[model samples]
Target: MTDQLPLERLALWVEKRPDAVWLSQPVNGQWHDFTWAQVDEQARRMASALQALGCAPGERVALLAKNCAEWFIADLAIMLAGLVSVPLYPLQSAESIDYVLRHSQCKAIFVGKLDEPDKLAPGIPAEVMRIAMPYPTMAAQYTWAELLAAHQPLHEVHRQSAEQLLSILYTSGTTGQPKGVMLSAGAFAYAGSQSVREMQITEQDQYFSYLPLSHAAERFLVEMNALYSGGRVAFVESLETFASDLRHVRPTVFFSVPRLWTRFQQGVLEKLPQAKLSRLLRIPLIGKLVARKIRKGLGLDRARILVSGAAAIPRALLEWYQSIGITICEGYGMTEHLAYGCFNRPGQVRFGTVGKPMPGNELRIADNGEILLRCPSLMLGYYLDPEKTAETITDGWLHTGDKGEVDAEGYLKITGRVKDIFKTSKGKYIAPAPIEGEIAKNLWVEQVCLMGSNLDQPLALIELSPAAREQSQEQVTADLAQTLQQLNAKLEAHERLSHFVVVREAWTVDNGCMTPTMKIRRNVLEARFADQLGELDARQPLHWQ
Candidate 1:
């Protein structure tokens, strides 16, 4: 693939297929398609408007919105204008929003529909220019229509080298403050092209955009891949309409994190009892028909590629999907690497391992068992944080915080995060992820977080599934005790759990327990439960709260 900027590719698509739909957004109750010409025209006008507002080249321009069609347009416009796009998660707190804006020194921000517009208003500086998207929001100086009508379409696209900064993607900050990751234009161009080629994505493939665009995985995988391959991208309206939207789009390619994948399985199990479903699937011909019907019902029958990443998925969950003829390929990557580190290719399938490194990408395990990667798509550095940047990238290799090992077949299996390993009072270190993954295999367990720190042994905080929550407490406790017994039997002495505490409340983004990408905020959860852990009896095998 040539080292052409995404905007250059968009320009080519506009010239070749002006009428072809590039983006689809749900409005009111129906889906609206935006053609390549429309995207180009709007992005050009957006660039012109930013230029009129005195946004200079290389200056940061923030885009704060949920997953929407305009988010992509704003990103392209920012790149076209030779400005850096700083995408902020819509669910970011007011404090985080202010911190990112101040850190990036963004001169202009494109605001769109948000869950809490009031929280955002106080964060944006009065001096910063605000452009509202099509969504109804009064938190902007100019609406999209007004800006397009007032400004002239910019005919000249700014030529940029591969090393030029494209966007500053902030980390989800599960442990500490979010750091801005500076990714170059070449990184996106290279990663996008590689993803398109590796996944065999083409203009005919359709992608559903439901994950936050601010995330590196979704941005590079879905948005950038679509831009590079001329694929159509469909945006989900809201969580309420997700199932309907998925059914409507029936996208050829689908990617989701492990949490969402588990939820999907839970949804299916809720409708059909697992025991009955398993019994039916034991039949030969009827099993195939049932599996196909089940896949169609989930709107994934048409999906040629189904990927699960952002976090490790349970092997049980992967096997469950595989039983239905859908192989969920688990991938491994990070924001610092443009999410192009390694992915399981079509035929080289591994159940738990995230397949071998992509073409031209180097993956080597450090002496400490941490994964080290060297790739063209690696980030330039962490924005304004030279010291941390140096710690992350050394000797031309990105030090992935994840601890993993490459198997004999070259497939990488992630063990856990280095920082997530907690030491017990006995001085033994335990990797919580594996234990958590094992506990999650029990269908009743929705979310599990293992913590020990200074405690004598590891303890588990588990959030039960909705179905499990409805069951009698005694029955739930008994099932969990059995599950814990099975899990502990396979674990080493130090890795064994002292007790399993049933968390009454579910962890959610709204409650500050989970990141926008649905990853549990370990620091937050640990802090919240710190006081209670001291009082819990280590002798107890199970505790109901």
Candidate 2:
């Protein structure tokens, strides 16, 4: 079983269970199912079309789309045609899109459902071939149905060597330009096979695919795991139908980012007040019943493995879910390693730590406390940027760039980013992650960034939750001041916050304040509020901006 790569695994599944439903996509309020054989046939036909269109073997082809059945088929077809796959973020800016297409020199692009096709159209160079998937997307030279009808299934399965380049997944840049991480076919094969084995995933399990598949974490979780385990994968049709689509799937294995998990909790609290929920949970037998009902309502009643990644989730959020019989295991990984690193196994999850290294992975702390990881699935290198790759990878261990400490029991807790540490005017260095984590525990705060950097005292730039924004500013301010005092008591004098400035604008992907994967771009936030924060330093403890 280990000898077979992804395409071989796909062939095995098709031969073993041709009629088994592998992909379920929602369109226009209707659901469509694609069996293993259907996916196999379509991918083969497309692979033939790509070859006939003059795409040479080992060339790059780009996939720009939302997560859907066709995205999977296009990726599979790329592999079948002996071409390397490059995935661009669906919400990526036009400038970034043009940069990647030009930098990678992709021979063609497969366009699918985009939020604004017109905004992305100009990014595609005129020379690159355009193929449109079966969705409302920009004009293309060839259509999905037209190609499938024009070509026959390519009988030959392109055999890829284990060391061959599989895909170039451009990072959703939070700091600088997105760099393509070159991963081998064996990298994902190893990570996915190991993950499924350790998590006890089986063919009977179901997977939900809503997160951006362009991100390594989501691709490893939803697509790779389903491929290795022969599980069926379902997708969300649109943002408006996310909740309903999630409930309809009830995936046995589910993964979400921290932002969405916080939103889920807020949704519950809005319907049933926290005070009422606390009371209902305190009753003995009724408490169990209430917890079960809540889990069922969230469609996580059947979830055997629920994971949260892309950013650190608050311990308070995890504890809240635990009270409701939902165990949200927070793991750690990066695009550089295909997101195959440390994980909190179901029976051995630690609250503050991303659990121990997996069986064959190595972990150590640098002299400066940066976490270093060496795994079998580490990327070959950053695409066409060996200087940057050399700076990142040394002696086979990927420098994670995040500061962390490990307990004697081997649990790893990320402290902060080495580059993110800031110094005060008084020359005291402070790590903002711990302080930010503490601030995030407050229910009223949606997002917070701690900044000081040569200032007299640190200040928190916060965004209010929707519910908090509705309440009186007086009520919110009073609560924040009390929480701030409590937090200051636990901090060094220089590390204490001076003010809390509420940001009026949202930090969304559209505005470029956050990455497509939903991690806040700290540099962008700081640059946006640097002047305002300095002006408000000597003002009041709290202000509504």
Pick out the ten consecutive residues of candidate 2 with the lowest summed lDDT: 530-539
Task: Give candidate 1 regions above 4 Å deviation.
Answer: none
Clashing pairs in 1: none
What is the lDDT of every predicted structure here? 0.89, 0.92
Question: lDDT of model 2 at residue 5?
Answer: 84
For model 2 the TM-score comes to 0.98
**Residue by residue across 1-545, what tens digits does model 2's lDDT show?**
55568898899999999999999999998999999999999999999999999999999999999999999999999999999999999999888899999999999999999999999999999999999999999999999999999999998868988899999999887888999999999998898888888888989999999888899998998899999999999999999999889889999999998888988999889988999999999999999999998888888889989999989999999999999999988899999989998999998999998888976799999999999999988999999999999999999999998999999999999999999999899999999999999999999999888888888898888988987887898899998998898999999888889888888998899898888888888888888887777667365888777
Clashes of each: 0, 0
Q: How many backbone clashes does candidate 2 have?
A: 0
TM-score of 1: 0.98
User: Candidate 1's C-alpha lDDT?
Assistant: 0.89
